[model samples]
Target: MTYVFNMHDAKTKLSKLVELAESGQRVQIARNGKVVVELNVVAKKSRPLFGEFKPLNIWTSEDFDEPVQEWIDAFAISQSELELQSNKK
Candidate 1:
């Protein structure tokens, strides 16, 4: 649920508002009667770095089979065709 507070009330009760926000409540601070800012609680999760020290391998078997120029020409042709179709519309 969202808790709405005017500017004065929000400033006076800042600690209590923070406590509520930390407990998963959305706090809206309003100037006069209009909402101006919002405070949200974001939960962060821990991630494991299992592959941090893995060796990098750039060369593959396919790289030897196909020339780099062939891939670049194909990509350029497709991009031009896409641009032509978009311009028609």
Candidate 2:
């Protein structure tokens, strides 16, 4: 549920309003019957700054990797095959 308070009332009960908002209540402050501001509780969970770190393997061989040109050629061939099969349907 939300509660609306006029500017003067909100100013006078600022502390109480903060307490209510912190307790998951939504509060709207209005000036001259127009809403000026809204207040609500926003819960935040803190995470660990440093949980885990993995070491890098800099001695990996580049010869075991597939060449980019070969992969691109295989992709083009597979796409052409798919297009041929679709056209035959």
Candidate number of the best lDDT: 1
Q: Model 1: residues >4 Å from true position, as ranges? A: 45-89
TM per model?
A: 0.48, 0.50
Highest TM-score scorer = 2
* lDDT (Cα, 0-100) at 35 in candidate 1: 96
Q: Please give the range of 10 consecutive residues that has the lowest summed lDDT in model 1.
A: 58-67
Give each model's whole-structure lDDT.
0.91, 0.88
| lDDT accuracy of residue 69 in candidate 2 | 91
> Which residue pairs come into collision in candidate 1?
none
lDDT of 2: 0.88
